[model samples]
Target: MLGLESLLFLIEVGTLIPLIKTNKIKYNVEEEGGCDDLDQGDNGWKIIHTDVFRFPPFKSLLCAVLGVGAQFLTLATAIIVMALLGMFNIHRHGAINSAAIVLYALTSCVSGYVSCSFYTQINGQRWVWNIILTSALFSAPLFLTWSVVNSVHWWSGSTQALPATTVLLLLGAWVLVGFPLTVIGGIVGKNRAGSFQAPCRTRNIARQIPPQPWYKHTFVHMAIGGFLPFSAISVELYYIFATVWGREHYTLYGILLCVFAILLSVGACISVALTYFLLSGEDYRWWWRSVLSTGSTGLFIFVYSVFYYRNRSSMSGLVQSSEFFGYSLLTALVFSLMLGSVSFWASLAFIRYIYRSLKMD
Candidate 1:
């Protein structure tokens, strides 16, 4: 299964890389901007320059969430790198899970720094409150998911149920380690954060968005955004699903690392491309759209997990199904956060680069 899965993921790499190359070449510009009055190259993404960085609605909250998402994204990559380097044997499930928990708890500082930094960039007023929300929104749901799954396992007399002492210790670890790091990171980020650099001055009032064609709609963008990146990792996803459900060991740390890197590249490219389209259409609400467009890969993954559970390997008990779906949801959420953040940051950078390159008269 792992062999087949590896082959598939590699195949996906071949398919997606070409597509990315084509898009990058097609969209590559050499400093050409036409006036909006004449409407020459105004049809391009540059037309909406003013509103592109108009501080998205709920800007503070979005930044906080993105900050945490970025943190997890980095943490995941670091963990995979460590595994590939033989810091810990990737074959050991217990080791991987333990490492992940410790890393996540300890890495909250990154979340705080990123979230608060962005928040500060947007000139958010309530720094402390914003940081609090960032930590809670990310950690609370995951903790609940874990608790639910553990309770289900405990009810079924499965050893997967973490003992009460261990659960308490996890809570203590979060409070002692995660929370403070987040606060410290938040403080440092806020103090050091610079203003968001927008190439063009944003307007106090927003421009009316024209009705978009069906292809430019959220559903269309979500489908393209989600599936393209998801396709890149679908084969590897099968192995991951199999290991989780089949209770098998995952030892492909090197392949896993490669897949992780490719996924990030694919995510960023797709995001920038899609954001360009949105901006060209004069739709300025791209902040969340960028996140959701790329994050929809998680939704696609969840859908595939349903297929995997139903058709692929078989472990058809209450505890098994519950654990599979529950953890899968968390997995999707994490992917949405991690990869989506990558996409957004890339899009943000691309937008800034392109806008700055233009000669605004």
Candidate 2:
């Protein structure tokens, strides 16, 4: 299963690279006053000035028709093969589960690469950061699942050990099929949308006033602004470890988790809105500061993980196994990445909103 998961991940990565290169996802830009150094060229202005603002939500209708449309082709192929096999009744669960995981994983990689590439092109962020973050988000779940499987002692008492052929097939699938799929996905996304670079423009020095002091710096604002979101996230971590420490009653845990998530999301929105309101009043320094709120979650998760490890007695025996420890670390790492990703994107969107609000005048 681990090998199969790896294969799926690789395939998604393979597919993502090309997509990132080609796809031109729409990005919002602030149109500056017409170019000043106007040499009378064929097109009136010799240069164009523009500022990148928000990235619009993926044009869902178009994405549905093209991006998802292509993947459906593969889905249809899988359905056809499943129909041909008389053993469908017996093999249905394993086959469908494996296919679904691969398909979704591939889709995520493609979407991420496309989105990242588009943003990188617009903002001129280094390509390395784009690729690294995209890869981390798409492959995070796989590593988490692997950690869970490795940590559990299936052969002890009643746990059934997986057969040898299953393991081999899983390995083969990732190496042969998954890796190729990911690479191809990336390439396709990239090819469709090239990188974004903000167009340069000349500004009138006389008209421009130095941005106000409270609005001139981002650091302090960002650090303080991150608190609400981080607090909500820490509340969440408290319960997660509470459960891992042996409270298995889902009734109470489930409700609290849902509440925690909702409040966290809402808090994030409010923080952004507040920041935007402040920035709109000419506070330029507050522009990117609200985004720091999400970073608090990452800090809390790290601290909570320490407590979880120390308190969970069942995990003690597993800790003795290098395999179990490896799995535990993997699980922690992936969960942290997912949470961190959520915070980052939320903060980014908020900051973009603030940037646009400030520049609109």
Candidate 3:
């Protein structure tokens, strides 16, 4: 994406440079012989230079490209190192699950960069909001869900069954390594692009460009783009819990399960992006939209947990509605938080790409 964004920036500049030269030549011709058109002479050149160089669009693009490249490099390096360091094999029994986490983490990095890029493209106004959105949208739900699941006995017992020493070490490592790396990525992504200057060139450009209709694209974007992966993760969570407890198979099929999950993920991405785009009228709304989408998912997950507890009477002991609901909420909360947080940062990077295309300066 960063590479693509950079290439797009070059294209925008290439388009602009010719216009700049043409305007300058026209102005020079009128100014040479006491022409009455000062507006067509030095003034035109001044305006052209201002638009071409002093514009936010150009500066923002530069920042976005550099920042995204930094983040992508960092995350890619971190994951490669993590895998090589035997993080993948740390849990012998949960090798498949662990590997999946690593894979998601890697993919999440891309998502984070893309989303951030897109949001930055729309509204480069609030960095603090961007930071908070990133944290809330991507990290908060996951953290809450994990904390809840670890406390509850309803899901897979792996988190609960782990020795206190191992859990502490794992948490510490995540805090020290995972959190820092993510923070670094966010900082670079946010700070890299300073601003975008919208070109009010002739209304001709705006008139020629058809307005992007919202409804036309929302469903497909949300379904295939966002929800598919979400479905995959949710399904995976279900299996992880079921398998850990050696529960009976209530699944319809294995391949279908994967399909559902991938669909869910794709849907979730589109849902967050489209919802925010509608609310703020700025693609950059991902900063907050990420939070909203994640929160919405959590709400649904919490509700589902309520249903699960009420219907699930086969568990070892009858858990009270309050506790059961709490467990269910935790399940959604953890996954939602994780997903929301991931999407938030990813959305920022994505926004940057959009901004780069628009030539904000």
Candidate 4:
């Protein structure tokens, strides 16, 4: 898997090199007194400079989603680092879950800071609603899933169901620790926020986006952008599934950490490449597209989970199936946010760098 990822990474980097060169050449031509007219058959990214930084619609929701993604990125890194340091027994699932819960509560401030700061930067007026949305982005869905799964377990009198007191304590932790920290962070973020600084000035009239090729469509982008990252982790995913559902034990935190890094790198590279393609087509709606493109990795993971459950595992019956699929869905959601954020940040950086280097007035 590592070898394949390394090869794929090299290929992605190779693909990006030419795009970067083309952008640089276009900028140089403009600087050298070449034609500046957009209609002169120069279909490069320079033509859409004015609209490149336009804030996408639903700015508040986008900010909240990005904020949650940042939080998950931090949480995953921290957990991996602690595991590498032998902070807890890898064989004990309960220990890991408890630690993750505590860390997530502590990390609530990160989500608040990111979401609120981004919202402010984008000129969002609904600060209160933005913060509320950020706080509930993942938690709400999780609660709903937990309720369904727990009810199933309760009806079956299974010991796997969490006790009512435990559920209350979890809620209490989020309400008291997580909520307060998020509010505090939101206050800080709002105060520290600055204006959105796009290198190119936007025009009063938005440019009409040309019809894109079939390959540049959102679904195609998702399929292409999601597949490489999913392939990078697919082999390791089986081992993880085996460890969790089967009797196997996994202690190679180091390898897992490496695969995790590769996953992020692949997601970022593919997103940047796709964003470049979209921009070359004079499409500036790259914000959500960049996210959804790579975020589709989660969809692939969920589909793989179905495959794993049907063929790879020996488990059976309603209790196990519901639990497996439910948690698998949550895992998919996490990956979507994590990789999606990485994709967005990467594309944003790429866009800014190219625009900033241009000879624009």
Candidate 5:
């Protein structure tokens, strides 16, 4: 599947590169007040270049989401590298969990910087609110889930519940270290930010998006975009699930690393392809669509978890099920943000590449 996707992406790049070059030539001639004999009717993507980079609706939320996604990407990569280098025993779940917690706190600045810089570029006025949103984007929901799961465990008198001191320590770490670093990063980012550098000038009024076919709709994109990346990692995911829930110990960090890379590549490729289709259809609202298209992979992950729980795992009961699904939900959320960020950035780069060479006012 990965090979096939890569082939298709290569084919797409080959086909589009010449078209982009041709469009650039014609656009340059038009700009110089010269006429080109070639018909311009086929330049669907070119026609919407003006609105392609326009800031999407809910720009603040988009910036925050992307920022958190960046943080997750950094954390995941760092952990994988450390594990591959044998810095810690992969079987030591406690050590791994502690390292992950510390790394996540340390990476808070990444989210802050990315979110604030992006918001600033889009000319956002509420810098303070943007920073707050970025800080709380992932943590808030996570805290809520943790609270519920901990309460359930505590009520059941299970040793799995975190002690009060440990919980307080985790909270203190975030409040003192994570939040401050995020604030500092946001301040720095805001100071360094500049106006958005769009290739073409946006019109005073927004352009009307043409009616798209059913296949071009957001749901269809999400289904197709999410499925491809999910398929790429589905087999590896079974082993991961077994390691986490069953008694099996997974130590294949190398294969895990390779699968992770393939997952991201497949996601990026599918997203770029979908964004191109959206642009060709004259749908300028590709911003959120790009995210959701690949982000939907998380939904598939959660669905697979349901299947695993039903068919594979023997664990049952309210407490166990609650704990399993709660953590699974968090896992799904992480993947969604991580892959969504990759998709959006890939599409953004592709859009910029194709539009940058055109001579547009």
Candidate 6:
């Protein structure tokens, strides 16, 4: 993803120029005493630069979610790259499934590390609680959803329902292996955690956000933001759906690799553009907005799933419907979190770079 990392870098070269010029102009003015009351009167981005890095609301919950989301993101990417490189038996059924399950169980360390490190940086006190939340956040929801769907299959006497032994094995793996790894990672991450450093010093009192136009509203930007990222991979998305839902065989690993890169690029660039727009409009509540904006790609995906279910596929029966929609929801939610993290991290880098460019006194 080194190339993909240039997403904001590529777009910001043009967009941030105006932002840079404006700051330079302001910089020349601030050299004198005329703009001494600038902090009080300004509705520009620099005013809120301080608050931008403030620990987000629900700091513990947010950190845990981000940690788990990031772990899954890494896991997904790793599995794809490994499959692309032929490190596994991609042609065999259940090979990918088995590998993914094993890798996910092992990646609890990542979840714990990121969660505890982030929580510590935010000055959080309850490290154990935060790590526990991180480990359980995604897995708990998934298990519950799986259990419900499996029960539905069981009632219909379908073979899709997991066996009792399998269920017990899964639980045992998580409790015995995943849980301890998470605890170890949390301990290490806390011990090695760094201080939270902001690009600018936050003001004692938060400045009231200036009124924004309707067009600049979060949802409005999100719709456009989501569309761009979703469009980038719509073609590949269809193929992915076909492979998952139909009898389509996807052997184009190279194309899949390209699409993966494109997905990250689209998500990062769109997020940076949207974040820039919001910042220019003097709205600083971008923490969740950036995530929601790019994550809305999942919304577009869910809509596509509906269309696929109704018109494309002839899938019928309670078991099929339950499985299709159940897994679809999980897929969309995971996609949202994964891409949302990519977007947020890209936006964070863009903000940091822009702030660094500023001639702050």
Q: Number of the top candidate by lDDT?
A: 4
Candidates' C-alpha lDDT: 0.83, 0.43, 0.44, 0.90, 0.89, 0.80
Model 4, poorest ten-residue lDDT window? 32-41
Q: List candidate 6 stretches off by more than 4 Å.
A: 1-42, 88-91
For candidate 2, what is the lDDT? 0.43
Count of residue pairs whose backbone atoms collide, per candidate: 0, 56, 74, 0, 0, 0
TM-score of each: 0.86, 0.47, 0.42, 0.88, 0.88, 0.86
lDDT tens per residue, model 5, 1-361: 4798899999999999999998787656655432233323455877776677778888889999899999999999999888888888656667778899999999999999999998999889898999999999899989999999999999999899999999999999999999998999899999998878676667666778888999999999999999999999999999989988887877889998999999999999999999999989888899999999999999999999999999999989878998999999999999999999999999989988887666443
Better TM-score candidate (3, 5) = 5
Q: Which lDDT tens digits does candidate 3 get at residues 177-244?
A: 55455455556655565454432222211111224466534344334433345444555545544543
Error of 1 at 5 (Å): 84
Candidate 3 TM-score, C-alpha based: 0.42
Candidate 4, number of clashes: 0
Instruction: For candidate 4, write residues 1-361 as lDDT tens digits.
Output: 4798899999999999999997676545555542332332367787887778888999988988898999999999999899889998866877878889999999999999999998999889999999999999999999999999999999999999999999999999999999898888888999999988676677667889998889999999999999999999999999999987888878899999999999999999999999999999999999999999999999999999999999999889999999999999999999999899899999999998887766543
Shift of residue 30 alpha carbon in model 4, Å? 13
Superposition error at 120 for model 3 (Å): 4.6
RMSD of each: 16.8, 20.5, 15.0, 13.7, 12.4, 12.8
